[model samples]
Target: MEIKLVPVRPEDKGTLINLYQLYEHDFSRFTNRDIDKNGRYEVNIDFYWEGDERWNPFYIEVSGTIAGFLVVLFENMDIDPDPTHVIYDFMILQKYRRTGIGRAAAIKAFKMYNADWAVTQMENNTPAISFWRNVIKSFKEDNFTERYRPERKKYIQELSTKT
Candidate 1:
């Protein structure tokens, strides 16, 4: 399946509300949030509509259908003098997962930004750990840095195109 990363337009908001709820449900497993009686989860996305220049939202498309969405943000965590690309959120529909589309999309995303990369995944998500490990390894080999931040209970990885 071919994956296309299309910039999510304002008209796509309603669809994203549902899709994002799906993502929230899956993510709730790693956090304290619980699925409501209706089997739905609520995550405030008001900021996404604020039209922030620092944030980007994209719909993951497969064969003209919306497979999922990815939210990328330019954030200055001030780890250094330069701002960095942060993959704030990424979710591929359950049906489209485990295929090569995700890996391809991630590689494409990194190349599109191409400065510095900082990615975090909940430590409880072993599959995410595996996915990030594979992508970073293929993109940076042993040149990348990864550490398990005990305070956040998340795996943090840093990479640079220069490396």
Candidate 2:
């Protein structure tokens, strides 16, 4: 299956915003975040695109169709001097599940960033935990670390590219 991550552009904002709603819809099952009675979930999309140079968001495309989106940002969640690129949000359309598209997109992101990387899944999301564990395991095993951070209640996978 062909998969790609396209940098979301201004003209695509409307489409991305619409997809963001679905992302939140799926996340609700694993978190306490509330959706408004009107069925809207709050997010800072504009800020994500404008306010921070370190924040990057991409649209996941499967064979020329928008499948989902993910945010890869240079953040200090675990704090390392070498800089850390984190995959903050990842969503794949239900129609595209279990087809290796997510894996291909993630592997592309790893090569594109080519730095210390972090991917975290909320502890309650078992499917996510399993998916990420398998993905990390396929990479260079010597450079990866997987563990649950009790304070944040998140399962974290960190990849250190250092020799």
Candidate 3:
């Protein structure tokens, strides 16, 4: 299947918002998040299209169908810079998980920006940790480092894009 990362535009906010709700729903099991009176989870995706050059938002398309979403952040974008990128959020819809679509989308996202990368997962999210470990290993061999940040309760996987 052809996997494509279609940039999310301002007009496409609603689509991204809808997809984001599903993404958050998946996290409900691993988080203490509760729906509010609006019956919707709070989503903070407006920054992507708010003219922040550091944020990249895209819809992951598989065989011409919307399968997921990815948000990449240029690390330290507002500060003294370094060659780094961060996979802020990545999710493949429930129906597309384990179908290789997620892997394809991940690799594509990695290749999109020419810089070192950082991917983090919540400490309790073992599945995400495993998925990212496998994907990063496949893409970078043994060149990446995985470390746990106790204060943040997350595992961070860092790798260089340079060959």
Evaluated with lDDT, which candidate comes out highest? Answer: 3
Estimated TM-score per prediction? Answer: 0.89, 0.90, 0.95
As for candidate 3, its clashing pairs are none
TM-score of 3: 0.95
Expressed as tens digits, the lDDT of each residue in 1-163 for candidate 3 is 7889999889999999999899899998999798879999998777777778888889999888999999988877788477479999898998999988888899998987778899999999999999999999998899999999999999999998765
Poorest 10 consecutive residues by lDDT, candidate 3: 75-84
User: What lDDT does the true structure give each of the candidates?
Assistant: 0.82, 0.83, 0.90
Candidate 2 achieves a global lDDT of 0.83
User: Which numbered prediction scores highest in TM-score against the true structure?
Assistant: 3
Residue-level lDDT tens digits of model 1 in 69-92: 888878864354567888889898
Sort the predicted structures by TM-score, highest score first.
Answer: 3, 2, 1
Better of 1 and 3 by lDDT: 3
Q: Which runs in model 3 stand beyond 4 Å of their true positions?
A: none
Backbone clash pairs in model 2 (N, Cα, C under 3 Å; residues 3+ apart or in different chains), count: 0
lDDT comparison, 2 vs 3, better candidate? 3
